[model samples]
Target: MSLDYLVAQPVLEAERFILRPVRKSDTGLISHYASDERVARMTTSIAHPLPPGAVDAFVARAMAEDRSEDVWVIDGTREGGAELKGIIGLKRMDRNQSEVGYWVAPPFWNTGLASDALQLLVGSNPLKNDTMFASVFQDNPASARVLTHCGFKYLGDAESFSVARDATVPTWTYSRKL
Candidate 1:
């Protein structure tokens, strides 16, 4: 899609969650979820113990880079008010091959927040029909299931460099053919 088109759009919503842009105030809440061992262990990007104020820094970057990452302030709409429950985004958005990635708070896990937001993240947007890919760590079953629920086909294993954790992580590739 064109740059102007993406910028003009507004927040996306699913049945139970709202995917709005991230604000500076969302740092604390992001850190809370991102810091979880269960949450961090699964993803190759996040560092263990989730460095202090790391989430704030990430949010700041997201706001600055409109072309690369469009973050969402995930709120549980069906359950209650706009209390920040998690964050989702179209990270690594290569117009030729964009990717969907997200994290929900531990308290909100097993409730379909990730899947719902993921659907919103890649569904019928500027690049929904195009080929989209996701690299999930082998150990994270929840993440694997999320990809499966989103209709992503298993494309086997691949290796990628993760700057956040400073390692070459093993990632299984999942793809949705548009």
Candidate 2:
């Protein structure tokens, strides 16, 4: 499943959630979850104490055709669940590859939501990537477990700047050959 079509935007379904393109209405929910200090610090981009309109800008960017990444809302409402449990995305990289990124709200932590979402995404191989890459802060062992449980092998150590932390954090990189 070459994700080339995703450039046109498509809805992907998982067992418990609907992964769809971001929507304007999601701003409030997104802002609410993203503003959590724990959530923001875990991500590369979101800042702690989220700025005004940050979610708005993010939604706008996700909806843009020229954007480098394809983002989706982890909508679980159809299952009688939260409207927004989290977010997942893929950033296009060179050589038929992409980087996977995701975060689940604190309420959903340890509930296997991340594992399910990631397994669904990787198993689908929507991007038709020969390989996929991911990284998690060393402090976030659960995230590292999510990748490993999905069969991603440890690649090495790396460092990435966390805007919310306002510092460089050690990361454990992983990759899978699809």
Candidate 3:
């Protein structure tokens, strides 16, 4: 289903930042952060050494009329923070379900930015989903803590391909009922 007409992306507020829809002007900062190996390797999609035009294509997809996912940038400029702290998104699924994904720039790591962003998104529940699912690579316990700290229950273990790692990585899945 196309969310372009069904659901309007909302700007969600948080104490430290706001979760706003991605825009064309965000490409440069996003590229700068996602290009970092430390950031890219942690995500399932972002390829390490981020190729040219990769971020532009990503922004295009986020703004597409028929997009399957709703992406938001963690903007902190409202409080004189970095304009682009990172990204958080929800990939639509059937049965009023959606999968959550997020990343924080290396500089923003350990600052509770990811946790705050995830909490804001979950609290907002923009898609009005019945349930929201999330997973983090087992190697990244910090992200797992972010989910659990936000009240997500551990579901089980799984594996997902990491483009940056170029291999299947073990993941811990978690879910929360909205």
Candidate 4:
């Protein structure tokens, strides 16, 4: 259950969806989902026109984590050969802490798939288990709601953020005790 042999993860079956890992083959899906201005706006680090090879670079980076962190948490719709639905990940995982970040294709909105994936990750066979942090956009109530629904409690705000939209986009901190 270490998944250490896996240089990259495949689809993870959840009660309602698949939480896979990003792959080089998934660049098309990445481009498709990242193309939308709204979705792109939610996480603007994904370049507006998403410069070519960006997804590959992202996958490369995800694979470079300390083998203890599940850097890429990509979601799909079914058991196999599923259309990539979104991406959720725990960045900068320490022995007992990590940052949760994610985005869903607008088509799959309001389905609770993101929450399901998160639950699956938390319940997955991983050793670095403990409290996890979520830095959500202050303006994205939907994300805040999802975090709350998944048992993450409000922990105030932080100016530090990975994908900051602007100086006004203060990040709200949340934590779920494991």
TM-score of 3: 0.95
* Candidate 1 structure quality by residue, lDDT tens digits, 1-178: 3455446446776777677777777787778778877777666677877877678678777777454766677876555855788776665555667777777788778988788878777674544437878878765777889998988999999887654556777888899876
lDDT of each: 0.73, 0.90, 0.93, 0.69
Model 3: weakest 10-residue lDDT segment is 1-10
Q: Write the per-residue lDDT of candidate 4 for residues 95-161, one digit (tens) a residue.
A: 7677777888888889777777777767662435588888766777898888888889998977643
Candidate 1 lands at a TM-score of 0.82
Cα lDDT for residue 32, candidate 2: 91
Stretches > 4 Å off in candidate 2: 1-7
The reply for model 4, stretches above 4 Å from the true place, is 1-3, 7-11, 65-69, 73-82, 125-127, 160-168
TM-score of each: 0.82, 0.94, 0.95, 0.81
For model 1, the run of ten residues with the poorest summed lDDT:
1-10
Candidate numbers, best TM-score first, in rank order: 3, 2, 1, 4
What tens digits encode model 3's per-residue C-alpha lDDT throughout 27-89?
A: 999999999988888899999989999999999999887789999999999999999999999
List candidate 3 segments past 4 Å from native: 1-7
Residue 4 accuracy (lDDT) in model 4: 58
What is the descending lDDT order?
3, 2, 1, 4
Top candidate (lDDT): 3
Q: Which pairs of residues clash in candidate 1, taking residues 3 or more apart in a chain or in different chains?
A: none
